[model samples]
Structures are given as structure tokens and as C-alpha cells.
Target: MLALSQGASRSAISRSNKARPDYRGSAFIADIHQNMSVTERGHFMQTKVMSTLNKKGVKAMGIRQVLPFKVLAADKYRAIRNNDSLFDLYGVLIGSCQYLTGIISARRQDELVSLKSSGNLSPNLNPFEHENIEYNLIFKLKKSGNGGKISSNKIIERPIAASIAKIIWRLEAFNEAARSQGLVKGKTLDLFNNLDARMCTLTKTSVKSFNAHLDSICDYFETPLVKMSNGELRRQYLRQHQLRRFFALLFFWQKRFQGLEALRWMLGHTDMSHLYHYISSNEVGDILNGVKATVIVQGVLNKDGELEKLKSIGELKATLAKKYNAGAVIIDDLESVIDLADDDDITAPHIDQLKAEANLESNLEELLKTGEISLEPNFFKVTDENGQVRETFNLAFQVKTV
Candidate 1:
């Protein structure tokens, strides 16, 4: 069990980062980290999404239970056979979460923007993008979302996209159930009349009333279902958004095993300082247990492991040589290979892109395949001519080349 620092207290944080939406593609893995400050199990979060401090200043304590990812996956599979409203609702939630994480309201816009700029975002395909599946899906979801009157300006922070998508998708299922019960009569403000607008508006309603609505669906749609009062219904169902956030924090820990720097990149943050709340001492125990080590002579010590702009290919090659502990570096171009020595300089503006690929197209096969990267603050110590400690850096942050 991991732990969160004192920063997890609600008094310190103004908003809760409790939602994980699936926005798969270039949004990729860190999409889970977007706007979410995930913490270990011990982290304190408010029970209610919006709550004022009590008389003694104690926020109600309740860790909202969530359907585990595996369970959701199974529910989705079952939905195909059952075609039940509950099952359908579960399926939409799970399906929409495959690549989304942060705020439910903003996901459609991200997809919309990404779709409009796919050419710029992904020109050379990644291993998973053999035929532009992500590009196509973004366009499709954008079209579906536009049909619902979603606004570009209405954005939310750190709530799970899946939960929101579930709510959006669940309404259709609810309306269908109500129709079956002949309850979709006039003047009820049909929740589906303007789906996106209703979605934004519905968040302002009481969770108990919203839950009662779900119970009404259960009574209307399922054949042998039990009914409950509003309070009973609200208490029975876990606070859905909190559960979504719990899944996200778990994802944050899971990704930490893949190297913190990589996780930071995927989240699209300029720096990784914000994620510090999730780290406890030695959380990334022993990453380079079996990696070969050699004397490094020429790499820049990157404390943050951020890809910084280098002046020339000569500088990049020097960094790579020291990082890999090799005298010479080679670039495999299929038909032929180019050898880059420490002193090799480049005049071509395009060729300088080797700096970018240094981190992306790196020799991290072992960690990438295993997802067990260790985070060490001081990877190696640098010595001057007199054997005095000059600089201390971590091996996990070493820059690499293609």
C-alpha cells in the first residue's frame, strides 16, 4: 500500500482530482495524470464533491468504492450478451475510458482539437498507430459529441472522463428505460433533449436525487430488481467520481514503475513538481538491479530528466556517449548506419532532431518491456581530476539517442 503526504489533506487542496477518463492515442498513458494529483490509499479526500468544513472542522471520511478495471472490463463483455440497461451503462463507461482521464467535460474538446490537428501531432506513426486508428477515433468521437450540443469553453479539472462519459451515456439508457415505462411524457425536461447541455446542468443537482433517478431506471428496466428510497439509493451506490479518481491514482502508481520522467512526459507538464504529493520515500525501489554499468565521462546531469534544447549534434552525441558509457554512437537507418563520434558536429537543421529522439527512441527496452523502472535521485557521482565529487545525477534520467 502506497501513501500520500500531508498535502493530501482537503484543507490544503482546493479541488479534488478524482476522475480518470480514457483519451487513448497521443494523449496516451499520462492522460490519466492530467489535472489529477493522485495519492496513496491513506490520502484524505472529501466524501462529498463540494462540502464546507463541519463544526469541529472534520471533513467526512469515506473512500468511495469503485468498480475495478478488471470488473468493468468483464461487465462490458457481459453487456454484449445481456443487452440490459445496467450492462449498457457499464459498457459505455468502460469503453470511453480506454484512453481518457482528466475532467469529463474537457475530453470531447481535447479529442476535437487532436482530431483537427492529427497531422501535426502524429506524422510519423508510433508502433501502436500502424493505420491511424487513434486519428480516426478522435474524428468519430468529435462528431458524436457535437450532436449533443457540447460547448468548447466548458472545461472541468481532474475528474475522470469515463465517469462523465458514463453519465452522458447513462442518460440515454435511462431515457430508454423511462420510455419503456411510458414515463417519457411531455414537460419532464427530457434529460436527452440537449444531451451535452443537460450533462453540464445535471452536475448541479443533488447526488441523492440523481441516484434516485437511477433507481427509477432500475425499477423501470430490470425485471426482478429491488427498489429503494432516495437516501438508500445514494448510500448504496459509491460516490462515482471519487471512485473514478481512485482508479486514476492507482494508474499514477502503476506508471511510476515505468520511469518517472516518461510518466511526466506523457502527462504533458512542463515540469514534474506537481506530482510530488504521490511519492513516498523509496517508492521506486531498485530499478537498475541488473543493468550494466560503465564509467560515464561526458553527459549533462538532468535532475528533472526533461528534454532540454541542445546547441548541436556534437553536444547531443557527447551526452549520449556518456549516458550509454560508449565511445562512439551509431544511428541505424535501415540500409546504412551513421557513426557519431563525440566531436561530430552537424550543420543541418533537420538532423538536429536527433536530440528529440534521444529520449523517445532510447535504449529503454528492458524498463519499457518490464515496467519496473526505479527512481534514484543520484544515479552516479561525477569526479574531477583530483577525485573530488563534481556532480551527482541519476542513471534513470540519462539521455539516449536513436
Candidate 2:
């Protein structure tokens, strides 16, 4: 089944995105059950599986059953996924480097939509540098967290580092396109000085225009992006707000820091309740599974007698859960999942390639003068007082190559 929404593209949600649409949002979930009946392969079968929902009637996370198959066959799926550029931001284009980086985040579109100048992110300069590294994608925000009632600016981690460079790259790409249109510009970085009403990008993409692309996405998945039910509408709202990214980030930090304090600090939420909606018991099993894997891989095989490092799997799960107190990970729940996951030995990837030596090359001073990048010489090892001879980068501009 193919579940989707109408007038609810990621860019379509109002300036104040009301929902968090992810791969698991209601419309997409519903479409999976209520698939394209009139396909070339004869009519389809669908079961209107529904679940209990919140007061405002958001889509319930619990669907009856999910069965995914090749809707277009392997070849067709590949065709769509590969040549998605024609569909641009509608089809697999959502996975494009530009779309992903331009909207570097799903939750903070509003804050990015408000960027008026480059001054918000001052340059980090170094006279002699051998690396391109930036600490953060600093930006001024109106009620940071893209209007979570936050009073100050925000600095969140990038998707996979090089976020600043990627942003500059996209900005340059947009400028190159805009320049061809005779839209008037000295430099796009200099011209995109303000976020106008209904706009979502420095390139001036408006919400009204952005929502129009919803049809293409539905058409590709052979589904309709309409709010026929409260669950459907709620899911649409969530997707617009990019709640998936918000909750995903929270959950990611939850796994990393394994604590509520880390979550509160990163999100800047007033208290724990501000994020209760994103919390759930489903993750308890995930936490346990992770610990279970660690037990089998590291605890059991690494060193059976190192009590401090090799803890009983149960204790490991408990400690991780207690630290990340966002969800309840009772032993009973974990036990049920334990029986299902077949644990076995796994291999660690050989870092033979990582051990290979490589050279660094870039016009550091040129990039600096143009404010096109940042430099962090401290990230690499210099053979001498002169910044040369480095195998890899290790700094905040997030270069973890080695």
C-alpha cells in the first residue's frame, strides 16, 4: 500500500511546521497497506489497519501489520531512484546532495529560512592551515530550534560533518543557477540578504510553491498526499515540521550520551516534558539489542574477565537506559525482544585502506579571503613548523577521514 499526503511536502508545511514527516509517517504507512489498486499488475489488496491516536488525532505509530514488496520491481525502483533528477525535489531527488544539504536539517527549516546575512556565522581563520574544519554551522534563530520558544541562537551537529562547506557549496550552486536567470546579483551569498514571507530558502523558494511539489511525490509512489482522516492530516503536519529529524536527533544523542541531561542540553528544552511526545517504549528493545550486540561482540569476545569493561548484558542495558531516562526499558520488555534477535559473531572491518598515506592540497589563502571556508590546522600532524605532511584530518569542521 502507498500512503502519502497532499499539499504537505517538507517545504509545504506552514512557517510553523505542525508535523514531523519521516519515512514512517502515517500517509506513507497507510499507502503501504492501501497500495495502488489500479496497477499494471492487476488490482491490489489493502487492509485499512488503524490504531489508537493522540488527542489532536495524530497518526498512530502502531500499524496492524506491515508487508513491503517490490512495487515496481528491482529494475523499475532503480530507474526511479537513479534518474530522480527530472523529478527534482519530488521523487528520489529528496535524496539528492543539494536537497539534503540545502535543507541541512528537517526540523530547523524556519531558522534557515530566516538567515539574512553571513555575519551570523563569522569566519574562523588561521594564517597557516592544512585543513578545512569548522566547529559548527552557527546561525541566528528566531526562537531557536526553529521557534521552539527558544530565546537564543542554536548550534546543532551537522548530519555528517562538513556541514558548513556543504552549505557554502549549495549556496554557490543556487547562485550559479540564479545568476543565469538575470535575477540581479553581485554574489548570491551577498544577494540572498533576507528571508521574505512564504520563502523557505536563501534562493527564495516559497511555501506555496514548495507545497505544489507534493503531487509529484505522491504520483511517484502511486499514492495521494491528502488528509482524508485525522491520522492522515496529523502525519502530514508532522512531516512538514520534520519531526522525524527532531526525534531522530534526540534519539541519536540519547544513544551517544545515554542520558536525559545530554538531550536537554542539546535541544535546550525547558524540561523533560517538552520532549515526552518523542519518547516511547519501543526504543527500550532497541537499547537492549544494542547492548546485546555489544555483549556478544566486545564483552564476550573482547575479554571475558575484564569485569569493568565486560558487564553482564542486563547491567549494560540498565545503565544505558538509566542514563538516557527518556524511555522505560523494563527487563520484561527487553526479554521478549532478546528471544527474537539471533546474536552471533561479527567481523570488524580492516582499516588497511585507512592506513594508506595521502597528500593534502587546497588553496587555503584564496578560500579564506573569499570567506568560502574555515581552517583548523590543529586537526592534522605537521611534519615541521611548516604546515605540511599530514595523513588525515581530526577537527570540528568534522573531518574524521582517518
Candidate 3:
């Protein structure tokens, strides 16, 4: 019986080896029926084993509890759809946020949305506050556009013409007051104070008006002075000044009579031939020629006599040049004649005699009747060192009306 059992066991081992070569090498499987069961188990384990356990010589066997194939497929489809809709929805939200707050930025939008979601929205916020946020966002975008930095100078510059106009207007008021009321004691101070106060108020009103006017002008020109750089605004202002100067000159010359009908009659139109005669016969000529020469001579004497007289002439020439808008001219040389005179007795008594004759000139009323009341200054010219004659002219008048 022992011989028979040994034969059976050997026969089983031999049969297991023939069926599975790996089974013979392992002590775990011996009996043919147990081996057959183990063989079936190994086949199951091999099919279900994870890749990690296969490498370690250990076979895995258990139910994986995997999610349903349909559920996983549905989740994938939803993820892809969400991705497609996200960009468009984000764009809409960003646009709405920008419209409401007047600001544009992803980070700012995110912050705002976060705030809203967090229930931190404030009802006390005013339009200005909302505007500030918008302004800040715009500023950041502008900075980003310009490489994330802005110059300090560019940020601080503004229109200067309005300020300049206010200053000029104040000066004109002061001058007008001084001219209307003669140089009385303490009157200048009083006039200046009154004008200063009036001008201060006027300046504010004028500036506001000017700003509106400038806006209109800009609109007409299709330009914005406020948005323009400082240099550009300055150039525009200079051009404006040129235009104003031209118009002011025209108005000053045209309104000679200053609303006086009688004065207008006396100063006839340019077309009238008798105008020159009226001016030449006026008593104004006498007062001007008499006192003017004396004043000139005395003023020159107070400065160094001959040299001073030359200086005075030069100044007069400059004044004429400006008035006529002409190039400067050098008249006859006075140096030689001035040198011949004695320093101790430099007074020209003949000048006094000329003054007396000037005083006898006809009155304004008589000159007006004759149509000879010329109030405009005249021009003259003389040869220079190189025999080149130059001409300069002016039309300035200072008349004291009675």
C-alpha cells in the first residue's frame, strides 16, 4: 500500500509539472486536484492583477468597484462643455463689470466679483467713488500700455493760457482805471485795490467762460486742449495770442472817437481829403510840439546831454519802428554837432522861441471846422554811414481833451 501511495504522489507531481511547469517549482501546489484548483486561481489572479503586483511576483484578486462607464463619459462631456462656455461667460461678466464701475481689468474685476460674492457691497458709495475706481483702472491700463510706468512731468502739466489771460485782464483793468482818473494822491492805491477785487471775481467768471469757450473751439477744430501735452497747448496759445493781438490792434484803431458823435465828426473817415488839414491846424499840435520838445531836451540833459539825446532819439526810433511794424532806421549823426557845443552853456534858447511860435497854433474847434485836426504821429527817414537811407514810422497819439 505504501509503494502504491508513493507511486500515486510521484505520478501526480509528474502530471502537475507536465500541465504547468511553474507549479513544479513551488511548494504551495502538490496534489493534482489542489494544483488544478490553484491553476484556475492563478489564471483568475493573472487577469485581474494590477501592473504593480505583477512586477513583484504577487497576484491581485478582488473586485475593483469601478465607476459606471456611462457616468464617467457624462462627466467628461460636461468638463469639455464647461471649458467652451467659460471664456464667453467670463467676457460677458467682465464687460458688465466695466460698464457698471467704469473700470477695465481682470484683476480688478476679480476683486469686485469677490467682494460682491462675499456680501461686502456698500450702498454708501457715491458716483465719485465709483468714478475713482474707474479712473484708477484706466490709469493702470494706460501705464501697462506704456510699459507699466508714467512720467511725473506728463501727469502734472495743464493748460496755462487761462491763467495768463486772467493776469493780463487784471493789468488792463488797473491801466484803464489809472488813465480814466488822473494821477491823484492815494488814488492809484484805491483804484488798484478796487480793480484787484473786481478782477479777482471777474477772473473766476472769465476763466469758467473761457474754459467753455475753449471747449467749443476745440470741438470746432476737432482737438482737445485739455488732453494735449503742455508743449502743444503752449503752441496753440501762442497762435491764439497772435490772433488776439491782430484783433486788438484793429479795434483800438477803429474806435478812435469812443462813442462821441462830435469827436467822430471832427476825426473824419480815411476817404476824406480834408482830414490832414484838420489835424495840422489843431491846437493839439501846439501843445504837443511845444512841451514835447522841451520835455525831450530836458530829459536828455538830465541823462548826459548829447549822448543822452542820441539815446532818446534811438528810443523814439524804436517806438516808431514798433508802431509802423518796420525795420529800424539810423538817421543823421548828432555827435559832431553835439561836440561843438560848450558844455557850460548847452541850452538852445532858439528852442524856446520855437516853443512860443508853437503855442500860437490854432485851437481844436477852429481846426475841426477847417478839417485839419490830425492826431496821428508821422514818420521820417535819414541816410546812414554807408549812404543807405532807411525809413521808420509810427502812429501814436496822446491827446488831452478839455
Scored by TM-score, the top model is 2
Q: Root-mean-square deviation of each candidate, in angstroms?
A: 26.3, 20.8, 39.7
Instruction: Write down the lDDT of every candidate, Cα atoms only.
Output: 0.31, 0.32, 0.29
lDDT of 2 by residue, 203-292 (tens): 343344333333234334444233222223211212333432444434433433234444444444566555432232222222322322
lDDT of 1 by residue, 38-117 (tens): 33221232223223223232223221211112335655433432333322333333223322422222223233222221
Candidate 1 residue 52 C-alpha distance from true site, Å: 52
C-alpha TM-score for every candidate: 0.22, 0.31, 0.15
Over 298-385, each residue of candidate 3 has an lDDT whose tens digit, in order, gives 4433556553545335654344345335532212112222343334242432332223223322222233233332234344566769
Window of ten residues with lowest summed lDDT in model 1? 289-298
TM-score, ranked from best to worst: 2, 1, 3
Q: Judged by TM-score relative to the true structure, which candidate is superior, 1 or 2?
A: 2
